[model samples]
Target: MEKVKRKIIKIDEDLCTGCGKCVSPCAEGAIEIIDGKAKVRREQLCDGAGFCLGVCPTGALTLEERETVPFDEHAVHEHKKTLADKPEYNITMKCHLCGTTEHDRPLLPIKAKGESDWVCVKCIPRLIHG
Candidate 1:
């Protein structure tokens, strides 16, 4: 197959902490934590929507145009199916406080002492600042 220039997710290994925050935001299941680092499992599976970019606290993920093989829809479908078959694959991310699964707003990481949790952007002031 001939390579073409297209947008794709790029991860900076030096910046990534492998926190697994970006894994759930990716609807395509293209991102995975391997060897304590975030990796793009398959280029074709990434739609380049950049949803994962929002959840990355370390700013390790970004989109860039590069020459690569065209996205394969068949491969994406297969990859999704494979992920779906796994019992641990969860698509919904819920707020740690309100127990709601809605993610329409940006999420913020709140850390106190040695523990950390994610709060939706709407709940930041009420939950953290207050």
Candidate 2:
């Protein structure tokens, strides 16, 4: 019988800058940055590859052995889809005018609120004058 290894990923929320440096490295998409902190959303996606832990510059991520339910690849993919629909707390964009923080790209001329401008909401004022 093949021995199934238990895996657990621990992230130091205090050390995490919410940079999301670990997200892409994880093939399973087990880790996500929520509210500016790295969190292991599901153990099923983690193959214990130590990819995320190694990529963390602040040493915020560490993998430890622990008792966990068996890893499920299917469930992991499903979980990743659910995460995609949820708002990303780490999403950040630069304002073209004031150079302040903007969360995401503009919706490309959505008609909401009688908005006809294509610029991001933060840059709308500058666009009107320019």
Top candidate by TM-score: 1
Give lDDT per model, in order: 0.78, 0.63
TM-score of 1: 0.73
TM-score for candidate 2:
0.55
Candidate 2 Cα outliers beyond 4 Å, as residue runs: 1-5, 80-130
Q: When superposed on Cα atoms, how far off is each prediction in RMSD?
A: 4.3, 12.5
lDDT (Cα, tens digit) per residue for candidate 2, span 1-130: 2345686787878888887767755667777777888877766677787756655667787788887667888887677676655444233434434555534644222222422222467667655687
Cα lDDT of model 1 overall? Answer: 0.78
Model 1 C-alpha RMSD to native? 4.3
lDDT of 1 by residue, 27-128 (tens): 778898999999987788888888777678777888999998888888878888878765435756766776566556566556555454567766777865
The CA lDDT at 26 in model 1 is 74
RMSD of 2: 12.5
